[model samples]
Target chain A: MSNFNLKVPTMASMMANGETPEILFWVGCAGSYDERAQRVTQAFAKILNHVGIKYAVLGTDESCTGDPAKRAGNEFLFQMQAMQAIETLNGYKVTKIVTACPHCFNTIKNEYPQLGGNYQVIHHTQLIADLVADGKLKTKDNKVFKGKRITYHDPCYLGRGNNVYEAPRFALEALDADLVELKRCKQNGLCCGAGGAQMFKEPEKGTKDINIERMEDVKESNASIVAVGCPFCMTMLSDGVKNIDNLSHTAVLDIAELTALSNNL
Target chain B: MAIIAQILFLLAFISAVTLFYKNFKKILRNIQLGKSISRNDNKKLRWLMVLKVAFGQSKLAAKPIAALMHFFIYAGFIIINIEVLEIIIDGLLGTHRIFLFLGGFYNFLIGSFEFLALLVLFAVFVFLARRLVLKLKRFSGAEMTAWPKKDATIILLTEVVLMFAFLIMNASDHQLQKLGQAHYPIAGWFPVSQYLQVVLPTSAQALVFLERFCWWLHIMGIFAFLNYLPYSKHLHIILAFPTTWYARLNNLATLDNMATVTNEVKAMLDTSLVPPTASENATFGANDVHALHQIQLLNAYTCTECGRCTEVCPANITGKLLSPRKIMMDTRDRLVEVGQNIDRNGNDYVDGKSLLGNYISYEEIWACTSCNACVQACPINIDPLSIIIDLRRYAVMEQSQAPNSLNNMFANIENNGAPWKYAAADRLNWANNLSN
Candidate 1:
């Protein structure tokens, strides 16, 4: 969309060139496949490219982190999948990973060590916040989001699961938008009904879906834009917005997308 | 007459301690029924958690009003119990005001105890109103329909009665001291109970009887409350320390990998790796209390039935049948039932009932979003989500039962290396659209 061309390299391609990228961009299953989430992946890559930071993706070598399988009570399948992923990651000697999906970030950072795959993994929001502070990324000319009311939906894996409640907020704060908070935020944030493998299945018979209830918090915030850190939350919240008539105007964008837009990348 | 009172006091003290010991031994045995887990690591951190969360009541600060009221009651419980030491000594030695020799320090101690007794009384009234009159949503969950509701009410009421007995005892004792009655020394301050002296009889003989009656009632009520801890959610008063000490220190996102499953997967992945030796009777996951870790079982026993877990659960808030509080309650109930069953039958007998189907249903287990809000909301670090996951593990692995959607998703993961049916080759497709 801008004047610059974007470059995304693969780990294998980089290693063949006698180069090791600073961080591996783990484009999770959703970021790679889900139509809505692919845009987020593209947007984040554009930001990294504009900032002139060297990053690589696992490409076809990447696999599911088995978060859903583990949470769905398929431990054997989870370990099998985790072992495969760990093998690929360890083969690359990947010591630091950055992912837009909190699920992937959590599994690689916390759960993977137990299975003999360990790395310094961080959610993309943390990377963005750090980049902003380092003067590598600029948001001062953010005409796109100037004065827009933006609320953040905390992904459980990133927030309560990892105790990372500030990095995402810091990213949002750097923008020119008026940062608003949801009624249930941080430690008390509500789920978007897409975790624990519920994202794949119909919720077991409840009066209302969890996403719809969470959307109520978003609606009450009265923010035109709801920023999310996890791709799963993006899909669920986007679908949830379609169900509410008054919230049709509300846009759910990933924090990376917002940052890319603001930076004019 | 004095010797007779001393003998009666000795009998009461011995029987109360013995009964409490017997009941506590059963509780310890029931906790041992769960599989042993090694939480003995991280000794320094564990004690720090006990000091902060349990003793400091740090987590309760999430709700300021409840935290303040609970602090009053908690401080009263700990501080006022020191006065019990004096009562015990006086009862045993057949002495009156036995610690009066400490003089000013004794007055300071009694003065603070009286002040704390009044605060406890006020706090108990507010707690009772919160439960009975206010009808708070967290207190009225489906799991709290009967015994839980009564248990909370009974604990608060008992505190109120106990505090009243304490104040009345001090009040009548003060009046007897004013009259210079025999065995009633002019010792100890009565900062709060002095106000109640207006309600006491001025006659020394009547005042002594009133003081004696209240003193016996207060001590006996405490002993009764001590023994009742095993049967009530009020057991949190004792178990909270151990529970916080043994709580899972890992991030909630990191579900523990099944080591047995890891060995099996490793063997399959690496040809040179030795095939894992399978135990003849190893189960995949927990179906009964015995399969769960002893810490989880302790978590069940330590749950205060506050419904903080349920209150913040996404599934429960959305009207799903999955209440995290109920999961803990059901585990405890089933564990107690299993203990009774073991009592009736020998250790080898099986009742064919389990926590999975008998108490917790498949519907409740599957409804969880696993957001960890429930885990975050728990004031004492009780992890209800772990129990839910264990139940899910039993449902999916042992019985090969799961919701149809999850079953399909699992197959997709097995075949496609993702939750969906996308080819792994297509993972780089998103990058193709970018200009190079």
Candidate 2:
């Protein structure tokens, strides 16, 4: 499925050679499977590689964090899946993890502690912001998005669920783009209609779709690009944008992808 | 004459209590139908919750005007109970103003009662106006049909009549005392009642009969109110304390994990520990009211049908079918139906219809975002989301009737360890052109 080569190590291979990476790169289900989301996964991985951070994937071993199942009220399936993932992570003695998907980031960071899988989990935006703050990663003056008005869509899980708002904004701010805030931003931000496992089912018919309502906010901001943090928001907001006839030129992307593109990674 | 009056008073009191007891037993049986859950821990905290939320009316204070009006009605109802004690003593002993020994204090007490009765009457009028005249949005909805609407009006009118009876009784008694009638002691000044004296009849015989008629009407009104509580939303006056005490103590945002399921899952993780064998008839979530926990059933009863939960729900705000207020109302309706069926056909009665389709539809439950807005908005801490989740669980696990997309997702998670259609071996494919 891929052509160009990159030296990516697996946790199993690293552990076999008696080595431990500094962080575990959790390529979540969507990151691995969904085509549009895979681009974000690549963009974030490039940032880590360009910054010279040692990270390994659970390659062929990682599973879903059971977030969707738990939210859908399938407790039995959620538990069975979660326990298996926990056992694998605990076996590796991995203590730090970074992921681009907020759903994975939230479930593993918040819910896994109750399931005996405790680790220092950071979203990719948080990790990139820290790297930039530490002078480990420097952005070049590529200005592809400079002076362009870009709006940020906060994922429900990462924003309201865990209260991580500024890190993603900081990552975007580094791109020199004119960051425009939606009317309902931060704590008051509306969902992209894909939370609570809604991404896995048809929305109940309503007067207005939540994402379309949210897209109205995006359009009102007059931003050509909609920067999102979660893969689900990317899918929903992109679909929302597609349904609007006049917004053909508008782009929906993750913060990591925006960062990678702006830095010419 | 005194003995006969005492006998009649005892008989009335017993029958009133007996009718109230019969309804109370039915409610107790309905609550017992739900599965047991432990809310017995953290005694200090639960009591504090009851004091603050129920007794203190802390949540109502969010709406300042409604809060002030409710405070008047609530304080009047409670403080007026002290006067009921004196009434009971006088009725049992055939005495007049039995607590009059505390002469000046009795005057202070009676004066406060009269003043509070006026405030209560004014508050009740305001409430009636909001319901009938202003037609507040929260009070008008599909769930609030004829009975619930009329029931509210009936309670307010009853309170007004009872307060009127109390005032007229005191006014005629004051006139009798001034006339120096036998056993009519000159004890206390009731400012409002004395004001009411100008409107009383001048004849001594007419005044005595008026006083006696009002006294009987007031006591009998109280008895009717007591029995009516079990069948009306006013049951909140009695159930709110216990409901708040047993409220779920988790953060409003936190959904409780089923402890039994968690334990079984933990056992499944450790192969040496044997997980309980799956029962063929074991239903995952709630299909009927009986699958819900006892606190949930109590929550259904404690709902004042205020519609605040529905008012704040994101699903409802977005014009979706889901209304959190309706969920509680439906649960309570189904509970009453189940209780009646059991009363008629023993405990094993099969009604054939379940709560899922009969009361709440799948469309309403599925529309929820599980955002906990309803829980945060609920004044009495009723959790409609818990019931919603339980019903969703039943939809997914028991019937395997989840939406097609969800079925695909479950299959993906089962086969590929994720909710997407991709192999884990290719997970690192995204990293391939990244380091070039």
Candidate 3:
């Protein structure tokens, strides 16, 4: 079946059978090309399957979704690439798309319709929240994720573009994590320097790279770990944490990783 | 003398009609400055703008006192023409007293018209004092493109002097039937004209000859003004109403894309729709007068220098390079300049000067956030955002020169899925633990 199943914490994943699909994880560029994102998505897919929710994967047969090309003024190319993905999704009979990559979520959900590629797109945090709301998955309950000082990076696409400030926070709060929010979060969240395809091109002449500036705020929080809702944010912030020697122990963790580790920890 | 006046009047009447008819065609034809397809739109709203602003003069009335003075003065010009007609008729019939033909019917109309004439004169006086004496500090930035302070100063001065002379110099009319009841009451005991009239022996009817003499000067002054109008900043007077009437529906404060999601396009655009073999130097954006789109050209003509755009402009406030008024003025001035040259089979400009290094410099273009505030404040509806974007389109698509941030973004869009140089391989890195 198509990995197009979308599950929410409190709601059924799919309309049928009362069980929401396990994961609406969007397999994005990092999944297709970077191997690490591929490994994470694959692992998440396996975890969802083991948890007994019907699922399907959509992007395996697709091409580059042209969110990058369009923002870069190569609308001509973006059109061709976006059309291919739209056709693939149609062929897979996919109804909803989910992703941990803010860029993929934004492009596929927001920009795709600009190019006539319309589909229901969401983020993985949204699905995880839905699961918790439905009481489908059991948690550690002892609060394995509790008491450590931590901060969350509001990925621009998730926070600003889609207004998804709550889903990630809900997931983090469910783990009983002590959250230290940076100065810039929610509505006024800074860009992670990856939007509008800036990740592919060189950063323009801005005061500072938005991602590094965001990382500085996270460092200022002195949180031991930096949590993220987006894969691109995870990588940029992880790199940011690694660079500041003092803050290197402040590791970057996705909500999924924290959620899965909650039971084990 | 009567025949001479008749011939000049007929000649002037014909010239005015012909010139108005011809230039109207030229403006209608020069709608597009070059070849490019743009959104074709909003006809009903355009009519509404015309009906409300031009025909009704609704916008002018927003400031009540000025509007009243202006209405009386403008209506005065129309009614005074009847007096001119009576004069011409009398002159042709070889009589100095013209209203004798229609008996009291003709004289009554002339008397009423003369009454309007007197009001027009004072209305012009009020307009002059409002600008010069009280001096709305709005004129401090008297480079005068937006506020039209200099033009107002000139027009107001000329009107006051002409009306003053018009009152004094015309003392020879035998036709000015004395309203024995003093119906044309002088509002106040004025200095020059009222005293000078006292010295004239009673109705040898000097007001008759005085009216005729002043009438010629008034009519001739108007004719000279008409000829001078197309060359002056005051051209907006002639252009404003029609331009306002035919204006595009402007999206104020926030620019709305015409291409909303529901618009249907084929899977791929048809190649036939694209023009083949455009000129190598042909401007893709507004390079010359003809390259400007119709609404773009419309914006040039419809400006009413109320200074609202300048007043709210952040750049003007912060003392920055951006001036919305300058952009509008420079674009229009350049178009008029180049349009004249084109009429002579001489092109004084190309795309490079007007678009790339505009009078409003390129740096100023970057400073704009595509904010429609300037667009919003323009009472006559100038879309500064669209103009800025059109030039940006030329710079980015045609010239391949965009800002460094955009360059990086484009590069990342090509390589990574987004703009930040985040590892594309780490895309799923955020999903590491959602599963329980």
Candidate 4:
């Protein structure tokens, strides 16, 4: 924390100072708990700080958004969890929210409206794209990813569910990498088999696992790096790449991480 | 003789109508078993949806050839029913060509009816060829086995025979009129039936009997077809309008929130609010037909069983056990079975079998990606995902029978306030040692 000089403020602390944040940074369960996804949460925070953006996390007040519970058919548990989060959010009168995870982004944007927690919910990539276009965050010259093949895997919740296909691409364009597309991309992209609360359960016995099949599409693209927008997609696709024969050569990075690295943050 | 004819007609009509009404009542009772929901909002949009989807048959345009063929049969069946009014009056009053008093207008109406009948007959043969001869992949599958296949064949054959009888009745009537027989009015032109006049027996007495036999058979066939609808997928003819009106008008991907759970959570958030006592309910999601919503019950009754939902399903394409068509069929079958059980034993009777395990396997429900492909593909807007999610709710909340990976995830969320095993204090570690 000393080396980074990151002045991360919680919503409670911000309220104590009588300062209201322009946006609430919702670091979802995956972003807060998963080690790989934690990197994404940090990368996004660094970008916000560098851009002089006003944002705060719920910190200790944060709880799971109950997306997995709802998707898994545990509506009782989901509501119990969602209501607590909504109460905390409404207490702060949060108007704008941005998250690095598509699962959280989707639930807050689409589902929370019905639960009376309506906010201007946005995925981090969409915010990043807006920031980049506004020239707030400058992209420094980086030789590492320049001309390197990177394929963007569309998260089911973000792409098909929400119809967000271009924001991540715009963020990736700032990296100056040769961005390719998997054949099954955009509206028709195959699930990484992580949506619908599948991340919490073992996949049923089948001839081929969904992730393994999706990895085959990635391998055919021959891109060394696969850019993802969702943490669940990152975990599943990372496992998928490892299961492939050429394990060491490929890397899976979140769009925020890619943005952070390219900007020398 | 006239009084005797009227008595026989009344008896046949009453019996057929009573049977139809009894079957309809059973269906209504079965649907009432579900929890009440209000799809009553958005009256204007609902009306528009019914007009476009149900009355317009707009979704059929996805397959142009099939749509054209289906339109012929659908229009023919509806238009031909207008003549039934004349048949009923003729049966009771012992008269022939009763509507012929309208002169040239009557001639045009009969002419159009005859044309549609021929088109309907031609379309039926085309449909038969598509199913039996062409062996379209969507028409034949695991769900298409036995009864479903036979059901399609039976409906097409019945329609063909009914149309043929109508033409035969007209041809013999025309022959009788040429001989200037009593009560056989000189009415209208029958282009196809006029050609059929040459094939009949020349004896006037024999012609009278043939004409009467064809007349009775045509009317009786119509009554029989009406009753057969409740047992076949052809129930779509009547149920389609209501089903379309109640379809989800929002984004196809949006899953509905369980209101009963949302209010409880709201109470938990504010301690001053009294959270409703958690009822020690037997199940969380749907365990039986009674667990579903009223609109869902309507959806089960409205399935055309054309297998369009199954055809577009990614799970089915990838060889998974999940078939949206099978899901709808199983719901209807279970509902019918439950209804019969109630009819036999009291309404409180329970069936040993249920939709979740007995009909739809857990493996099948878990296999769904919840892609909304099936819902989008359905012509009448039947949502299989809603049922799938409800059953999954039962599996996870009531039985706690979720896959092992899911249990671990739930525990992680409970302990760490996230879906991982790490503690909250360690959440900021990734931000450390950054160049910023």
Report the Cα lDDT for residue B358, model 2: 92
Off by over 4 Å in 2: A1-27, A30-60, A95-115, A118-192, A213-265, B171-199, B202-205, B256-274, B277-281, B429-436
lDDT of each: 0.90, 0.85, 0.58, 0.85
User: Of 1 and 4, which scores higher on DockQ?
Assistant: 1
Clashing pairs in 1: none
Q: Please identify model 3 stretches exceeding 4 Å from their true place.
A: A1-265, B16-43, B57-149, B158-175, B179-206, B250-283, B345-355, B417-419, B422-436
> What's the TM-score of every candidate structure?
0.98, 0.82, 0.56, 0.84
Q: Which candidate is the best by TM-score?
A: 1
Candidate 1, residue A254: Cα displacement in angstroms equals 0.5
Interface RMSD after interface superposition, each candidate: 1.5, 3.7, 8.7, 3.1
Candidate 2 at residue A178, lDDT?
Answer: 85
Q: 2 or 4: which has the higher DockQ?
A: 4
Better of 1 and 3 by DockQ: 1
lDDT tens digits by residue: candidate 2, B1-436: 8899889998999999999999998998899899988898999999899999999988887678888888999998999898888888899899999999998999999999999998998889999999999999989777889998988999999999999999999999999999999988997778888888889999999999999999989998999999998888889998898889898775443455555577788787776886566444556799899999899999998898888878766567667888999999899999999999988999888979999999999888888776565775677888898999999999987887777888898888988888878776777677665654
The 10-residue segment with the lowest total lDDT in model 2 chain B: B250-259
DockQ of each: 0.77, 0.34, 0.07, 0.36
The docking category that best describes candidate 4 is acceptable
What residue runs in model 1 are displaced by over 4 Å at the alpha carbon? A1-7
**Cα lDDT of model 4 overall?**
0.85
Fraction of native Cα contacts kept in each candidate?
A: 0.85, 0.47, 0.06, 0.43
Per-residue lDDT tens digits of candidate 1, residues B255-373? 88888888778888886887567565778889899999899999999999888889899899888898999999999999888888878886887988989988899999989888999
